[model samples]
Target chain A: MPTKTVAGVTVDVNDEGFFTDPSQWTEEMAPELAREEGIDSLTDPHWTVIRFMRKEQAEKGTGPTVRGLGKTSGVTVKELYQLFPKGPAKIAARVSGIPKPRGCI
Target chain B: MNSQIGEQAATAGQPDPIEKVSVIISQGSLEGVYPGLIMANGARAEGIEANLFFTFFGLDVIHAKRHEHIKVASVGNPGMHMATWLGGVPGMSSVMTHMMQKQIAELDIPSIPEFVEMISDTGAGMYACKASVDLFKMEKSDLIDQVQDIITVGEFYDIAAGGHIIFT
Candidate 1:
């Protein structure tokens, strides 16, 4: 229930900074969220992944797994790490304004 | 400046040892293959290097002909519900395998072959045990394309040096 402001938009975020309710997300907030996730810039490849993840979450009711993202997101796994280090799926989901994907562990 | 001091402090520590994880898969069942695959994928997602060494019965997990057909172990599996006697019934293993596969599918998990490909594509090294290959009379041709090599235990250990080793 904690709220944080990103890109001048107020949204619900968990302690881990993952969005609690994805409906409040906006594309404009992605850069700010990405910065907090240790990414200073959103390259086209990053946006490609973020947009793909948002679309998948909206349609599938859950975000894609890291493997699924690597295989289908038009981004290779090696590049995924280069884009979102440490934890690509979790960080990408957080930046994309989606819930933490299930089966990530 | 505070940021300068923080940067100095960060660099003062010894460089972090490369994060490497070696996962050994010793069972061939559907349940068996997933743990190693999931862990390796998770590790790579975190920017860590991961290697999977498949040995013994685990060879089936990477076998081109068998990887896609791994079945759940029903008999003697305490996790399975129903009497042990019922587990021995003919066709029960297939029933259990189907049920488990359906449950995993409902969770949207990819099939075994898909998982192997995904993990491999993610840069995790997939190695088949040389001893198992010789014992089972399997050639390199018998393995899925994702397998990086058929390696000896000694070779696996050499690759695993300075890395965390997990047996599943």
Candidate 2:
């Protein structure tokens, strides 16, 4: 396991920088992690998704799929791409302090 | 240090993730179409650009009337585990297709049309083969609205340049 320091706290992470123990996450660390994922700022829509991801991870033990996010999250799929370019689900999961979603779509 | 060696060292050890994918779907069976759709959708989910080129029988996937009603082939498919003779019986293909649709529904996978919409919403390109359209005597209005264009094999190659090409 690797470790990363964010928001003045050190935590265990996987080789890809996803948190190994999501319990160690705090809201304060979100903006910093988002920055690490190349998101320079956390807007209202971004927080909406991050909060939704955290809650979904707590119940499901994994982040939602892209389709699931589009169906459930208030943010549309196109908006998600606007918020998190490149890989929306993967980057959002990393910022939300959850494991990568295992679904193929 | 030589410039050649420096360039090699700079490019050699860096990880290069797949940035794009062009999936060619040449089969029209339910099983065949789903694999290509799944792979193309998966590529977009991973932040990779994806283009789906539907040719030959695969054009049924985007056909306005046939896209929503693709059936699983019961005969000549070993994966079904039934005798080939039994698979040829009337209504067997429908039964198998219904069963497969139920299973796919249980997994929360969308129907073909819905899946196509989802992929389009993700900005993945969808194309129909011009040669197939001509052979089938189909018009532009025959395809779903999601299809960006009807292109030739050469055009597909031009768009797929520098990306992974998957034939299914």
**Against the true structure, whose DockQ is highest?**
2
Candidate 1 lDDT over residue span B65-110, tens digit each: 9987898877777878678899889988889989888888877777
The 10-residue segment of model 2 chain B with minimum total lDDT is: B8-17
Model 2 C-alpha lDDT per residue in residues B1-168, reported as the tens digit of each score: 699998988989886889999999999899999999999989988889999999999999999999888999999999999999999999999999999999999898988888988888888999999999999999989999999999998999999999999999
List chain A TM-scores, every candidate, in order: 0.92, 0.96
Pairs of residues clashing in candidate 2:
none
Clashing residue pairs in candidate 1 are none
Model 1 misplaced stretches (Cα beyond 4 Å): A1-42, A55-63, A67-86, A94-102, B1-18
TM-score of predicted chain B versus true chain B for each candidate = 0.87, 0.94
Give the alpha carbon lDDT tens digit for every residue of A27-97 in model 1. 99988888877799999999999999999999999998786787689998778877887667888999999
Docking class of 1: acceptable
For candidate 1, give the DockQ. 0.42
DockQ of each: 0.42, 0.75
Q: Which docking band does candidate 2 fall into?
A: medium
